[model samples]
Target: MKKNTLFVFALFIFYFSFCLTTVAQTRSREDYEKLGHVVWEVDTKEKIVAITFDDGPHPVFTPQILYILAKYNAKATFFVAGNKVKRFPSVLERIAKEGHEIANHTYNHIINRNITSSTLHSELEQTDEIIQSIIGYKPTLYRPVGGMHNDLIINTAVKNGKLVILWSWHLDAEDWKNPAASQISRHITKGIRPGNIVLLHDWIGTEYSRTSQTVKGLETTLRFLYQNGYECVTVSELLFRSEIIDQDYFNTFPIE
Candidate 1:
């Protein structure tokens, strides 16, 4: 009788542990699917990656970067701030004209979590308006400021017909802090992988003359990706190639 009771208790503990683990895994998968964000890498058996530049449409750096991308015949995504769009409308047109995808990076580039739903919607909607006015089409993609996203922001974005894009890899160039271009490039090259979304900035400090180092680093990074057989593409193409569901998963949420 004593042995049987002990055996039952041990089985019960094991079963409970298994159930918890199963629940956790299920929740993780559900979260990944609903977010529509890149959570895990897909084994496509081909070397491909997406390069994205955010907080841009700057007067000096943006044009130079576009020139390089055009010269290489490479396509990338630019998440432009709405205020910047208003400041440099021509740059926005140039980006669309070059065949690269333009995505919303919000109006003021503020932390979404700190803002109310109405404020968040305004940020996104105004940006979309600015982008559409310039590009003649509404952008379908968005990247939250600083890659900081939450349930509220994601829901708001989905309701407004935007897909929240997050990077699988980051360059951490800290261009805002004036980090060296070589250091940024080295970080990216050392950490480069298939299906990676390499992050860089076309916007820099007021005192900076030109992003010559970033341009040089971009050249080096592109050459390395090419040599490694990785085909750089836009974010949408990457997601489509990976077969992410098109239907909005957070549609039930309110837009504003």
Candidate 2:
């Protein structure tokens, strides 16, 4: 009888914890917007969007992505890893030279949950130093590794003078999974809204072909946006261009 009772109690505890996690993950974007440091997407009516790339500065893919951006006359934000920056300093310089924004993606791309506060600070500091060395200034924006964060991460990042940047919930192209270029392009273009922050990856591991697909997919999406009279700008541009009033309620909430 006691064994059965303990099993039932265990199940109840598991179910209760699941419910709490669900609630935490489902908080509205407005709730986050009010926090001043978390910005997933800006509220605006202009025909512009922020196309951001992460895990990049690859010797080959970075230049390809840069050429495409130059061809379309679009600016983007590159959230590059510090370790990659050390290996490809020139590529990082080119990203800065091209008038794109360079944000920090941590030193080793360690996710927030896996690291302690001290480790997180070290990651940010090391990345900041490398980026500053290459770009002549430190980055003000920081995207948590894997888009995962907690109160400790957020508070620590704020203390370090970084704003936590994330992508629009509907705008992730999921190009890392090596989807068809057409599908990836269509997904981004369809979800393109004013002030939308689109997420893409330039260096997706050693899978050379996968990153190539992202390049191809981005080309198609850029062509569509260029021809459709949409200006693709960096994340900072999107934020500044928008007249976001603190009291205004954003219609959609991005997943936490």
Candidate 3:
């Protein structure tokens, strides 16, 4: 009788531990769904990545950047700030005219954590209005400043009929602080993978001289990605890949 009681207690403990582990795994999956950011990482297999430029449409740098992209037959996504668009309407038009995808980076580039709902809405709406006025259509994608967003931000964007675009990898070029061109290039070459959304800036100040270094680095980075079988694409294309992944996940799970 004593032996049977001890055996039962041990089995109970083991069952409880298994239950806990299962619950933890389920919770992790739920958390990942909630975050819903970084739909893919660039790798050799998928052979596609996105180069995204933020905080732009400045007078000096944007044109030069566009020129370089055109030279390379590369298309990129530009998440322009609303204030900058208002200040440089022609620049925004030129970006749209040049065949690059334009996205919202908010009217003021407000950090989601520090902003209220009304403020967030205002930022998005005002920027959308300005961009639509310039481009004749509002962008359906919004990338929050610094790629920092919460549930509220995502929900707000969805309600406004926009998708929140977040990056999968960061090069940390720190162009604002003037990191060396070699350093920036190295970071990108080493970090790039398939399905990656790389964050870069086209404008740092009024001069736009910083872009010269970035452009040089881009040449090297592009060569590396191309050699490794990675194709550069726009944000819309990358998002489409992510949607396919989501559908696969749902099909596999088949939630009942």
Better model by TM-score, 1 or 2?
A: 2
- In candidate 3, stretches whose alpha carbon ends up further than 4 angstroms from where it belongs are 1-44, 207-212, 245-256
The order of the candidates by lDDT, greatest first, is 2, 1, 3
Clashing pairs in 2: none
Candidate that would win on lDDT: 2
Residue-level lDDT tens digits of model 3 in 165-225: 7676465566555577677678887877667778778767664344556656667777677
Give the per-residue Cα lDDT of candidate 1 at 167: 74
What TM-score number comes out for model 3? Answer: 0.75
Q: lDDT for each of the candidates?
A: 0.75, 0.83, 0.71
Mark the regions of model 2 whose C-alpha exceeds 4 Å error after superposition: 1-28, 207-211, 244-256
Poorest 10 consecutive residues by lDDT, candidate 3:
247-256
Q: By descending TM-score, how would the candidates be arranged?
A: 2, 1, 3
Candidate 2: worst-modelled 10 consecutive residues by lDDT: 246-255
So what's the TM-score on candidate 2? 0.83
RMSD of 1: 10.0
Clash pairs for candidate 3: 41-194, 42-193, 42-194, 42-195, 42-196, 43-193, 43-194
